[model samples]
Target: MRIGLYPGTFDPITHGHIDIIRRASVMVDRLVIGVAINRDKGPLFSLDERVAMLTDECRTLSEQTGVDIVVHPFENLLIDCAQDVGAKIIVRGLRAVADFEYEFQMVGMNRALNDQIETVFLMAEARHQAIASKLVKEIARLGGDVSKFVTPPVHAALRAKFS
Candidate 1:
């Protein structure tokens, strides 16, 4: 089976992220949403919280697309995580040229680390190209509504955090 790994800090998975997940799911037999447990990054949501939230949010999409979505929390190198999960493809989302430049460099590094793994980039839809997790958290912290930027579960989590 063509298994794909989509790894991210996923402080709070946004609509833009779900878009990429949905698109990537269609291209692979199974798409594992690997949540990066990078404590050094100090993400807003805890690793377990992020995994639970994303799992709750992705259930419907998995049903609709017939793509098995598993939210796995990981530490250590991401390539190692992918290898552990038997993923030959790494899926990434690109929001703009800036995103491309950064992802391009990382892709080469990931390739150098594991030539057996290939990275695939999915372009964000025009509507979501500007939505970013940092901005979303900033807006939420300042009492701005982010209902349109994230799934309902994520929106609720943000509200709970900021409240």
Candidate 2:
């Protein structure tokens, strides 16, 4: 089976993320969304909360798109998670030139770590090219409307976190 891994902090999964996930699903037998647990980056939501929110959001996506989504929390290295899950490909969404530069570097590192694994980059839809989790959080924290950026469960989680 062609299993793909998509790793991110996903402070809160955005609509852009769901878009990528849906697009990636077309090419892979299974898509594992790995939520990276980074100690350096303090997120708006806890690991458990993020995982739960992602699970819920993905459930909604499955119903809407008829694609199976598996969400996993990873404290170890991404390559390790991919290896454990038997994922031979890593999927990433590129939004801008800067994102390409960064993702390219990570792809190289991942290749070095696992020579058999390959990284695939997908461009975010034009309308969502500028949306990101950090931006979503900033907008929500500032009391601006982020209903379009994040799922309803994520919005509720963010409100509960910031309130």
Candidate 3:
């Protein structure tokens, strides 16, 4: 079975993330969306909240795409998470050239840690490419509309947080 792991903090998963998940899911038998804990980011939503939100968003798609989408929250090394889930591939979304450089570095490190695992890069759809979770949060924090960038649940969560 070809398993792909997509790991992110997902403080609040955006439409761009959904785009990548949808695209990536098709390429693997099972796509595990790892909601990782990023201590550096100190995400707006708690780990449980992020997992809940991601689970809600992926529920229907998991069935429709014929991909077993597992929302697993992890606080350890990414390769360890991949190993635990039996993921042979790691999927990443690239929004721009800058993202490429950063992901390239991480991919190199991941390769060093576990040579058996491979990384694949998916370009974010042009329309959704600019919609990043960090920017979406900032926009909502300042009372700007983020409805277009995120799903209904996430948009509602942002409103409740700022309002």
Q: What are the Cα lDDT values of the candidates?
A: 0.92, 0.88, 0.93
lDDT of 1 by residue, 45-139 (tens): 98879988899977988998999999999897989999999999999999989999999998889899999999999999999999999999999
> What alpha-carbon RMSD in Å does predicted model 3 have with respect to the real structure?
0.8
Best by TM-score: 3
State the TM-score for model 1.
Answer: 0.97
Q: Candidate 2 lDDT, tens digit per residue, 53-108?
A: 88987787667666677998899988899999889988999999999999888888
Index of the highest-lDDT prediction = 3
Order of all candidates by lDDT, from best down to worst?
A: 3, 1, 2
TM-score of each: 0.97, 0.95, 0.98
Which of the two, 2 or 3, has more lDDT?
A: 3
TM-score of 3: 0.98
Clash count of each predicted structure: 0, 0, 0
**Candidate 1 lowest-lDDT run of ten:** 39-48
Stretches of candidate 1 exceeding 4 Å from the true structure: none
Candidate 2: stretches off by over 4 Å? none
